[model samples]
Target: MRQMHGAWPKDALPHRIWDESYMELQHATRQHEFVTSLYVQAKLNTRALLDQVIPAYEGVFSDLYSATSLQVLRAVCKDKWMRRRL
Candidate 1:
């Protein structure tokens, strides 16, 4: 009985390691999925707002989210605002 009890911890070590590793993996996977969903939702909301604000935006820029397109939009808005002030 003493020998069996001493060997039990050795036998259980691998199982304990596997269980903890699996739980860690599950936590990481859930965090990744949550972040991905948030990104998708943000993209959808941006598209919806752009469509309402500038119906012809897509006709001008092949990639609406491109840096160049965004810069041009900022410049144009700034020009308009400046003209209004003048």
Candidate 2:
């Protein structure tokens, strides 16, 4: 057991260090969550944009352009085996 000293400083160095570390960890966690949320939102927006854009140009473009666009789109949006090759 430790004896209490009334004259000791209430905001000791160790306690201040621990509080600072805890605040930093909490701030980092919040930042990570914010970034992850943004990434998910961007992904969803990309998928939606691809859905709207792909069909509009599919048959109107030249064969090479059409094929490459489709291949790239599939690689980003699907889990097919071709995605592994990309």
Candidate 3:
């Protein structure tokens, strides 16, 4: 098992990296749009939306999640997973 101390980044690193990448994605708005549009345009497998949308949104959900401090997110995510399975 990897030692807890080995190369583990500081706590801030995750938030920092997340913020930077979000900014980068925002900058490359076209790529972001393409990925999203592709998902929609193809009428992706309903299961795809239910299983994958949260992960695709994972990169940006934290901010709004923090503000809301609600379980709706979990429910919504679970619904997606359920739809995918059904």
Best by lDDT: 1
Q: What TM-score would every model get versus the actual structure?
A: 0.61, 0.46, 0.23
What is the per-residue lDDT of model 3 for residues 14-35, given as tens digits with 9 covering 90 to 100?
3344577787878799787888
| Clash totals, every prediction | 0, 0, 2
lDDT of 3 at 22: 85
Query: Ten residues in a row with the worst lDDT in model 1?
Result: 1-10
Q: lDDT-based ranking, best first?
A: 1, 2, 3
Q: Which is superior by TM-score, 1 or 3? A: 1
Error of 2 at 21 (Å): 0.6
Q: Which residue pairs clash within candidate 1?
A: none
Tens digit of per-residue lDDT, candidate 1, span 8-43: 753455344457789999999999999999999998
**TM-score (C-alpha) between model 3 and the true structure:** 0.23
TM-score for candidate 2, residues paired by index:
0.46
Which structure is stronger by lDDT: 1 or 3? 1
